[model samples]
Target: TEPLEKLMPIDGYEDMPLVPLDIAVEPLVSSISGIHIYAYSAKERCKNPPADDLTIDESASIMLYSMDSKFGNKSLHVILNEILKSADKNKLEPWLLYLKLFLTALSHLPSTRRQVYRGIKLDLSKEYPVGETIVWPGFSSCTTSINFVQSELFLGSAGPRTIFSITCYLGKYIGNHSYYSSENETVIFPPTQFKVIDCLNQGNGLHIIQLQEIQPCFSHLHAPVFSSISKKPSSKLTFNSVVNHNTKWKQRGVTLTKHHSRGPKPDCLYLPYGVYVDDNQTIYIADHGNNRVMAWKYGATSGQLIAGGNGSGFNGSGCETNQLNKPINVVVDRRRNHVFISDSGNMRVVRWPCENGTNGEVII
Candidate 1:
C-alpha cells in the first residue's frame, strides 16, 4: 500500500542502518557493568520449592552410609519409597546427617529420659496445609531452629514444679559450624510466664507458634523434685518455703529502683513506665512523673540523666531537643545503638543516637 520511495527505504533498513566499519564498537562484555540477561522459569512461582530431588547415585550413597542394622531395613525401605515418591534430595542428606547428630545429642543429654518412642508413620501430602493468619507486632524476624528443654526438667520453689515445658532458640548448623544471622534482630520472651496459644506449620520448613503471657500460679502437679533437699519443715512461714508458690528468680522480691525508699532522686525513680536493658546490663528507665529518662550503668548507685529533668509537672512543653513531656515506653535498637521513647504527653515519639545522648530527634 506504500509508495515506491517508502517501500525502498523499508526494504533497505538493514543496509541503511549499518554502522561504519571504521568505528570501534565496544562489546557488551567490555563495559564496567556488564548487561545481565535472565531467563524466566516456572520454579520461581513456588512457595516451598521441592529442591531435594537427588540423583540415583547420591541416593545410593546415602543408603550406603545408612547401612547400620539398627536403622532397620523397613525404615530404610520406607525412606527410599518416600524418596521415590517426593522426598526432596537437597533436604535428604542434611536431614539424615542431622538425624544422626540429634540421636548422638540425645544420648549425651544430662537428664535421664523417663520414656521414649521409636518412630511414627510418615504421611506425605501433595501440598502443605493452609490456615488462619495472626500478626505479631513487635517481632522483627523468625529464627531457623528453636530448641527447648523438657518441661518436666524445670523445678520451682515449694518443690511443686508448675512449668509444663522450657523451649530454647538456637542457630542451624552449616558444615562444622552453626550460623546465626546478626543482620536481623532477635526477640526475647519473658521466662516462666508464657503459654503457647496456637502453633501453625508454615510449610516452608518453619513453624509459627504464638505465645501468651500467663500468671506463674497456673500450674499442674508434676511430681515435685527439689535440687536442694532438706529435712527442714515445708511450711510457708519458713525461710525455705516463704510462699506457697515462689519463683526461682534470684531477686525474689527486690526492687532495683528505690533500694532505699520511693522518691524522685538521682538513685530512685518516680512513676517509671518504660524500661530497657542492653547486653552489657545497662538499664534505661523512662521516669514519667519526673519528666526525665535515666540511664543507670551496671551496679551504679545513681543514674545519669539522658533526656529531660528540667522540672516536674506539665507546666510547660519542652522547647529544646533534650526536653521530654512524659515518656511512657522505651525500646532499644541494638544494631544501630539507638534508644527510642514514646513521649506520651508530648504527643510524639523520639530517638537518640546513643544511650548517653542529651538531644533526641522526633520520630513521630
Candidate 2:
C-alpha cells in the first residue's frame, strides 16, 4: 500500500463514517415476511420471480386489499376523505394512499359503472396460479403475456409504486348451435377474445388492476386517431374528391426546418440531425454538418451556439468541453439542470452544467 498522505483523491470519492453491521441488519431482520427480495438490475425495475410467479388476479386482489388495509375500508370516498385529512395535517400517508388509488384507478373501470364482472376471487393466493387457471378475477388460462410498463418510487411519500402490463385472452363461448339473425344480415364471430390489464403494486400488500377489452383490428394494437374527423357522424365523399380536398390544404408545411438563407452562419443551420425541446420551450439542435449544438428559444429568429461551432472538422475533437466532433443528439435533464450531448465523432458523450455554460464534462 502507498502512503496515505501521498494518495490522490478519486474523481467522486469522499471519506465518511463507517456504518455498524447490526444497525444495517435491523431493518432487514424486522421486515423479513413482507420483504420479497427481487433481483434488481439497472435495466429493469421489478423483475418477475422465477418460482411462484404472481398472477394478475393475485396482483389485483393484493392491490385492492392493500388499499382497504391502508384506509381500513373498501369505500373509495372514505379513503379519499382520509387522504384529504392527512394532506391537511401535512401527513405523507395521504399522498402515498392517493397515488395507490390513482394506480388502482388505472387498473380498470370503477365498480360504480355497469361492468360485467364474470369471475371474482376473495382469496388470491389460493385461487391464482401461473398457468391453466384464472390469472385474474375475470380472466383465466388465456393470459398470453405479462409486460412491464413503468415503475417509480416517489420521495416525500411512504413507498414505491410499480405498474405492470398484462395481456390475456377473453374467448367467446356458445352453449347451443342457435344463431341470432338480424333483419338485414347474420353476423358470425370467432370464439376467442383478448384483453389488456394494467396492474399496480404499492411495494406492500396492496395491488390494483385495471382491465380493458382489446378489439380486433388489422393486427395493430393501437387504433389510429384522426383530428379533423368526428366519431359520431360524418358526410361521405368520393375517393377523387377526398384526394382533391386534402391537396388544397393552405398551411405552412415546414416551420423550423426552413432557413432564411443557405450558409454556415450563426443564424443558418446545416444538416440538422437530432432535436430536443425542454419544458421551457428551449430547442437544442445537433447541427451535424456544422459540428455544433445550438440552443434556440421558442419563436426566436436565430439560435445561440451552445457547443462546438468553430468550423466543422474531426481534427477539432478533444477532451476540452468547448470541442465536439459531429454531435448526433441532445437531451436536457430538467431536474439536474444539465444538457447532455452525443458527441458521435468524438466517440464520447458529454454534458454541460447549464444551458449557457462553457465547459462540458465527458460522461460516456
Per-residue lDDT for 1-364 in model 1, tens only?
0011101001111111111110001121132121111001111221121112221112222222222222323433234323322323442331332222222222222222121111111211112122322211111122222321112222112221112111323211111111122212122111123344454543433334444433434221121222111111111010112112222336554345544224457886754655666666666777765777777777787987877775432323545667776565667677998878767656578898655687888878
Q: List lDDT for all candidates, in order.
A: 0.36, 0.37
- Give the per-residue lDDT digits (tens) of candidate 2, residues 221-281: 1112122111111111001111211233346632454452334576777546466766666
Candidate 2 clashing pairs, residues 3+ apart or interchain: 62-207, 63-206, 63-207, 63-208, 66-206, 107-209, 107-210, 107-211, 108-210, 170-193
**Candidate 1 segments whose C-alpha is farther than 4 A from its true place:** 1-253, 259-264, 312-318
Question: Relative to the unseen true structure, what is the Cα RMSD of model 2?
Answer: 22.7
Candidate 2, 145: how far from true, in Å?
53
